[model samples]
Target: MKRCAALCAGVGMLAVLAGCSGTPEETPVASSPSTIGTTSAPAPAASVPPAGPLGSAAYQAELTKLEQSLAGPLRTLTRVRTAEGLTEAMTTLADSLDAASSQLADLTVTRRLTAVHEVLQDSLGSAAETLSNSDRTEANARCGGVAYTSQKVQRQLRADLSGATVPLDRLGLKFGGTLPDPGPEPKPVRPSNGAIVIRSGPTGTGRLKITNGTANDVAVSIVTDGKPPAKPHVMMYIQAGKAATISRIGGAYHIYFKSGADWSPTRRQFGEDCSFQKFEQAFGRNESWQVNLEPTLGGNAKTTEVEAY
Candidate 1:
């Protein structure tokens, strides 16, 4: 009876094991452990949209930015005092303008603004070429006067910018008022080599003879040696390699002089390459005073550069 009971129990355990190992189609199969909690696949990355063409306002704003970038460099170029300095400044300006033209070329503009953009780019390129190809000798000659050189460059830049005026105005864009005008050129003086202009002070028997041996024309002024320094008593224009004498009686006074090119009689100064200087020594009353404008080795008189009046 005990053996039959043990055999029946073993058969019952085998039947339960067969039921757990049923066929794939009849069984409810479980997911793998790795994918137990997963619900769906990962999403794809988002893409950026393409930029559209610039409108009128946007195009104008871009042009204004370019102009602002160039203004400072142009002003700096005008302030350079020497020929080499002017050349360097002009090259820098040309480089800046060329870069600006390239930037404009890269911009995408609407159909209406396309023509305007081309005009601006062409103007900038042309101006840059003009400056880069300027004659060095001409640039040096212009360097004689800061004011004269400044005026010339200002006009040139203005003319170049003005080439786009018609197109810019047609589009109702801002133009023509960007660059500041440097003013008109002064009239040239046509006085003789020994012209004299007596300004002020009482007449006297004193004589002043000026010998101008330098390359530039010179104007000499004899001023009273007062507590605050009085106005010049007598003025004379002596051309280069010439001499002039002013005869009159006057008290002790100091001598001041200016030299340069393109003398403007109305303004009483040179239009370019100007310099002002004064003798350190003072001449006494009723005497003959002689001076050589050019500096000489072992000279007795001392001169100092002074500010313009």
Candidate 2:
């Protein structure tokens, strides 16, 4: 009986060991292919192109309109003939430019057109500044200078907007108007024969005896020797082959003479066949001097040709 029990126990132990050693089914796991020797490529980045002219039309129209508005003021400004008129006209032009600049600020333009728009804006400002900064005294002296400045500003603006992309006009751009003609040539003032056209300064015991041996009429100017030199202290005219005396001349002075046909008082110069010369030596008060208009060999006084004073 003990032997059978021992054999049953051994059989049970063998069966348990066999069950523990038996293979069991497992759940399948998801996986990709081996990545050790593989690489992933990223997608390409997107690109955007520059805008074309389709977006530029509206901005161009606005700019063209703005440019046209300046023509009236420019016309008025350029038509002015006097300094006072120029001052008034320049103020008007500057105001117009200011208004244009304000309008420009409200505009919306494309990237390429933005550069052109900024150039226009800058030109307007520059023109306004130029008008504002003009020297009033100089303007009064030379109205032509004012016209020149205006013309220069207009030319620069035109040149700056000359690009193909610029909106010159729906038709064409007009910046300023026609400049007025510098009036008719001033009529020459011809003094009578042997006339003293001008005489100034304190009178003294000095005197001058002038002899004209040439065929043409001669005018002699006693120019004062001082600051702002060449100002005439006494001016006298002598007919051909005539003699004249200038008495009561005062202070130190130089002798200048011009032989010509027509004498212009405003220009202080002769109109035709003008020849200007000045004696090298200076003469003082209370001295009597003699001058010969005819050129002489071995002359005591030296003379040189000088510019029209």
Candidate 3:
């Protein structure tokens, strides 16, 4: 019963969820008895300069950019429940984390404020690695790792000289399941043929029912055309032999499911004619659908109409 409408809409406000050093200075080159006499100066104090810099105004600006980079990707990573969605979201998240972690290493700060930055660097990196490399069946179940890790970075926003507040409050970010948590891990659903995609958006509030019948897990991608510049709006995860609900959705859109790896060999898409606007108007208000993946004789997934409400 993990719900939807939380990805980019933001019922209230904000957003993921972090990152080098210079070589040691040559010991004040001993005069080797030659330069030592050059200056009537006391022998230069021998010391190794600190490796990294402390936080600064410039550092704060860099934090701001990292904050922005993390917002969309973190939200997507937390909300997306499908294998493909997880893969896509993690891919995006990893890119942002990679940027943050890499940049964090090179910044030359005074006093070396490494603790906070390292917390974020490790969290984002760990979360991204889990999503990117974990087995497909296990990826969605591991989303909790992404949530709490990013939340740690979120809590440090205002405290940091960056003083990141606006983004922190939005998305209603929190820990311990304040955000929707996927139910018990589901069994993999495998559609012998291919899965189905049904696009819908209820006028006010509506729920979407997606059922995956096969033994392998299926991931759903929903995109809306209600406004121009259509983008991926919501993503759902349906485990094998499991049914999940997208409790809230509003607008017009189409969806496509990544059945088993069978579709990996070729690309597939849904037509605009399938927009739920047609049905919402025809049926008036509340609209729901049952998307079932039926296997085909060939080693492929085929699209078919199930039922709509």
Top of the candidates by lDDT:
1
Candidate 1 has its poorest 10 consecutive residues by lDDT at: 14-23
Residues 1-309 of candidate 2: C-alpha lDDT, one tens digit per residue: 000111111211110001000112322221222112211212111122123331344544555565566667767865766556667777776666666655554454445444445555665556566566665423322322344434444453344334422443322433322323344445556566668877888887677777787888778888777723346888898888887888887876888887776555655555455567777767765667666677554444656777655
Ranking by TM-score: 1, 2, 3
RMSD of each: 39.6, 44.8, 19.9
Whichever of 2 and 3 has more lDDT, that candidate is 2
For model 3 the local lDDT of residue 181 reads 36
User: For model 1, what is the C-alpha lDDT against the true structure?
Assistant: 0.63
Error of 2 at 85 (Å): 26
- Residue 207 of model 1 has an lDDT of 73
Ordering by lDDT: 1, 2, 3
RMSD of 2: 44.8
- Which pairs clash in model 1? 144-273, 145-273, 204-248, 204-249, 205-249, 206-248, 206-249
**Which predicted model would earn the best TM-score?**
1
TM for every model, in the order presented, reads: 0.56, 0.40, 0.30
Instruction: Kindly indicate the candidate among 1 and 3 with the higher lDDT.
Output: 1
